[model samples]
Target: SQQGEEDPQALSIQEGENATMNCSYKTSINNLQWYRQNSGRGLVHLILIRSNEREKHSGRLRVTLDTSKKSSSLLITASRAADTASYFCATDGLNYNQGGKLIFGQGTELSVKP
Candidate 1:
């Protein structure tokens, strides 16, 4: 599958701490998007980084992509209990034969305790 695979399938952190997750994919991609999902809820888009861009940020979130290594990382700073959620990475590319649809990673489950 061309889907990305997230490392450290689960993570736990205290409030005010930082959390990081990693993802790796097998094929070339045009863009990668990160999404967050609360339990029993739909995903919310976090950020997107194009293949040409090395990094991007949104509020307390930071994302870095390395096309050469086919990997990406998401960092959340000063995390709160509200930030507890599952994070997913999705990619779009020639190998993603979903008719321009995205291929998603397994996802990383994050838990933040106050």
Candidate 2:
């Protein structure tokens, strides 16, 4: 039950604005990762936050975790039109030993207009 479901199914924003997305899971997890997909392409890893850590940051992205609530959030600062894409959260979900196979959630689609 480590499946992580993202909230706010869709988001729209202008260039230079900040975008925030949230994810909630149903069980304890070893770690969680966020990914981005542009249009018809595959997902690309943005960040990974371990259960023992509360927050992490990479480039313009910030991620936070709350084990007590089994939830996490991703924040993108100063978004650009190129940032328009689908975002997803993934976890081990009992498949950790199967070549890193992961369980993904329904994603949040973000649109950034220039």
For TM-score, the strongest prediction is 1
lDDT of 2 at 97: 73
C-alpha-based local distance difference test score of model 1:
0.94
lDDT of each candidate versus the true structure: 0.94, 0.90
Shift in Å, residue 6, candidate 2: 1.0
Q: Candidate 1 lDDT, tens digit per residue, 64-91?
A: 9999999999999999999999999999
TM-score to native of every candidate shown: 0.94, 0.92
In model 1, what are the clashing residue pairs, if there are any? none
Q: What ranges in model 1 sit over 4 Å off?
A: 95-99
